[model samples]
Target: MRAFDPFGWLEKYFSANTLHLLIRAVAVVVILAFLIHRISLYSRYLFKPLWAAETLIFVIFLISYIIRINPADRSRGVREILIPLAGAMLPFALIFSPSQNLITGQTNYAYIVFIWMTVSTALTVWGLWTLRRSFSITVEARELVTGGPYRFIRHPVYLGEMLSAAAVTIFRFSPVNVLILFLFVAIQLFRSKMEEEKLGHVLPGYIDFAAKAFWFWPGPPKHQR
Candidate 1:
């Protein structure tokens, strides 16, 4: 008995390489469009000392994601390569793994994944809009923002990203992706600490804000009583 292949129809008309390239091109176009929209929304207020860091981080994220989604680079050996290159790239890797194809035939699973993606996207957008002009890619205190989602967690943007990474990993169910997610969590925690330190140094009210709000969750920091 021949095994059933849901995506076999795609291969009948398009070569695997061509299909992969098409998928990647679509991904790139979508990402670029979103980034262009975001930059336009924030363009007027983006002129700051820290905008360079923001731009660099965005570029690094885009490049890393594009690399990770390449079909040619999805080999087991490439995982070894990615581990070393997985500093800022780990989050993108977790959120967008090349091994996970976009050809799921299970409607229930697709619906669940869609719901998760929707929630994560909403959270990310809310976090971005809340931060507004104060959004910096690196740990810098332009203004002490403690409203909207920040009222609960100091790093709502990271929290949103974490939710997104979790959703993607859950949808794909890969051990390597779980490991990448853990690494992303560690990086975000370290970044959050650095941000808090910078804000505490620059803003006199940050210490009090830290006492009231959690770093990345609902509760206060572990060191707090």
Candidate 2:
């Protein structure tokens, strides 16, 4: 049996490198379809401040998947694969539960929400631009990206995601949404641990980078010893 590298767990069953890639293309197609639906739905709100910036983040995501280079290695186990899939799909699940407003939905709350989204979207796009071809949804060892927002945070993308996701969760507050948000953040943090473990094993410099960089919080970039 051949492994589908892109889907990660499928690699448990499939075997060829090219087969991995072809399946990866299929995975990208699925992501592209989902994101396109999101982009269209959100574009209707383009008149909102920096709304297009948020939309472009999706564009970057699709492009990153399309242009990403092959990983040096990736974990093929089902556990490693499913953790990320859960994080990716968690938000979509929120569509089912009715959205309960967290606050009075005042103009002040609106401004605060928009600000979080704007900042988070900027951070995400910055990390994405830096990560670009090195990006992967699954736990894969690729090039060590140590520049840009990565200088300060070990996982700027995850932080940005956390913030943006938090903002969304706040707006769509509900018991189910809260649980989903908690799991999403917890999974992201755990995924960071998995990534660091993989990178420390596979890339020589990452261990050193991890030491100086904050996990998700902002901090000064790594400096000379």
Candidate 3:
């Protein structure tokens, strides 16, 4: 009787492509589970006027990650689509490729990456929890939430998201990923400015809040007349 060869079976079935697909599948499942968990937790607050916008934002964030994990082909030649898509997807592709060389021997590097991911995740969760029902996708003043993370930064959520995104990019360590991170930062800054504009216009105390809170860092308060 022949002995069972588990290693051979695994090597045969779990090729590079198969492993990449498996990773992508696991990522999708995890993301969906997280989203469902958050939705369930916030179910009571879903009836707010800005619920649609908040839901849209969540959907967009999820979709962006899904696309990043399993990106489309770049041969389609759409420059606008390819740039961001390539930036997000190429890192994973390289990481999973059989010919690629990863720094597996560096234990400290791995530890740092783990720490970065943990901190980023905590920041993002803190921002979300602090926002609670006040969270809105658009720049509408659902409420001027000044407690928790908002006390230090006017846009703590953006800061958290950007930090998480940066950590992911750093883990991958690619120029394209850096470009994507920069682009994301620019978008978040613009969004923050727009939100401030709307809040300042609608909420009477927003000016005071802005004057007291930094945009996304711990610094001197904004100058107000």
Candidate 4:
């Protein structure tokens, strides 16, 4: 009789597809749990401006990532995965950082903070809305999205995230905070490059789509023009 090996049994029982499905299910559960926590935390400030926008972005994220087409090409390398993960976690640094008051001329910071956060959050929400089912953190290609802000720029989500990071950095201004913000933006841009490469490889039209708009700035998509 052959000796039983637990690892062999696990491998035999868990096919790659099954393992992937299980991992994704676990990820969804964790994300939903976090979303619930965030909602509970923010519920107290429901009357506050941009209240729904705060959670809406994350909800859209969960939806897009969960209910999406399988990737034609995906980066499963540890570096690729960690890059986006690091970028995502960088903004959380602001949660513990101390904020400083800034008095610019006669304007109070409340208006500035409100306007800045609102605009940035709106941009993020708009991008997420456009992405709907295609947006993801990892570098992968699903369906191409060319509507909404994608018509304006290649990566509105990253721009919005950077803007949000900037606002938070400003709120808690410090040398270390600024460094973290810059690092976050750099990672985002790097991830965009990887995404562009992967998309262009998997989707033939991505080249033309990229040409339609600048990587960071606004321009018309080819179909629109």
Candidate 5:
């Protein structure tokens, strides 16, 4: 009946209006498409990378919203959107789950979530923007992304997106939300394997980059040193 708003849940932790839902939505779609392009050769998974389960879930959410919002279909609905809503909300909405009052009751935690959301969103925007010209969503991915945040981090945007979602989970403090994040992490790891194969075959510098860069997460392990 109500839309899930993660930023609203974290309003206590940081000032309101830090996260822009509309822009963030656009960013998600763009990034998903970009990542999907890397694994386009797979062909069976709707050109979806193995790690794009979150994007798939969001796409389903978009479809559900379309069904709910269409005035003509509203009356002839096959099923209420409750189940899909719960699945979608479980990832980020749990921060305000049970009730928003319970979360706002702890202003400090709320503030922390808000701040994390704000910082993560800012990094996402900046990182994505830095690669704007180099960004692509077609089958042909970038040759290399060493210019911007990519120089320091192979997956800065992914990290930022994960952080933003994590902030939402912290605000909600739901076990189910943590589970979804874990699922996402697993998907990203799988996608990394597929991407490395693609890059090694097509892109020139990828192997060297992989040698230096951490796959999904950042930072080299002690053993690497």
Candidate 6:
């Protein structure tokens, strides 16, 4: 049997309007990334404003992530960049070999958002619960946490952030929304990974911890092939 053409439904929306939306969406994502990088660069100097804005934004992201528990967040820096780029590319691509199902009035990929939201939220709570004491943005961090979610996944909070951000994009199902979300995911992912590398290098038993926990998804380490 031939492989199913999952993206075949995009045949119906091959118009100029969709193309324009896609181009604009791509532009928006690029702008967001540039702005975020600049903001992060000087956020320390403008701590109050940056912190306030990101806190509110992340809180909203957290709430959305928690709403869904089964779906999983597959966000990483690559995914963060790809999602918006994909949204932008979708219009042109769909014109020839489409993937979305327009007749249903729903994108074929919406289910992924649902799954990711639930998974991300669960991981976030778990990570927070595990590292209750070490949960500060202070430079000299407190003692390492090896409890709750931390015991299972090394970076549950990051996972949650990625998941939630991606979920929001999928739910909105718009070019602009997806683009903004992609940039947020990319920046946070970079920040988290850098922290993880630094912290893992310092904290004792980190080598063992690294050996055990998965980087993104929260669970027992998968068996090596």
User: Better model by lDDT, 1 or 3?
Assistant: 1
- Quote the lDDT for 3 in model 2: 45
Candidate 1 per-residue C-alpha lDDT over 85-125 given as tens digits, one digit per residue, 9 for 90 to 100:
35446766664554355425666765666566656656665
Estimated TM-score per prediction?
0.55, 0.81, 0.54, 0.82, 0.50, 0.44
lDDT of 3 by residue, 37-147 (tens): 656655554233233334444554555444432221111122222333443343234333221124335667655655665565566556766665554343335566788
lDDT of 5 by residue, 132-217 (tens): 53432211234456656666666666667677777666656567777877765554444444444544555556666666764454
lDDT tens per residue, model 4, 1-225: 124233235557786456546646776788788789878877565235566777887688678657755556544664457678888889998757776756233257746865787788888899889987676676667788889998868888888888988987887788989999989999998888778767766676777878877676332234432
lDDT of every model, 2 decimals: 0.57, 0.74, 0.54, 0.73, 0.49, 0.47
Model 6 compared with the native: what TM-score? 0.44
Residues 1-225 of candidate 6: C-alpha lDDT, one tens digit per residue: 113221223325555345434534564465456556645655453224433433433343333323312111112243333333343333222223222343225534555544555566666756755554344321222356677777777767767756666655545556665666666666555555545554545555655666677764332222311
Model 6 alpha-carbon drift over 4 Å, by segment: 1-116, 137-140, 216-225
Q: Give the lDDT of residue 159 in candidate 3.
A: 78
Model 2 collision count = 4
Model 4 poorest ten-residue lDDT run: 1-10
- By TM-score, the candidates rank as 4, 2, 1, 3, 5, 6
Q: What is the lDDT for 13 in model 5?
A: 75
| Model 4 misplaced stretches (Cα beyond 4 Å) | 1-13, 43-47, 103-107, 217-225
Worst 10 residues of 2 by lDDT: 216-225
Give residue 30's error in model 5 in angstroms: 10
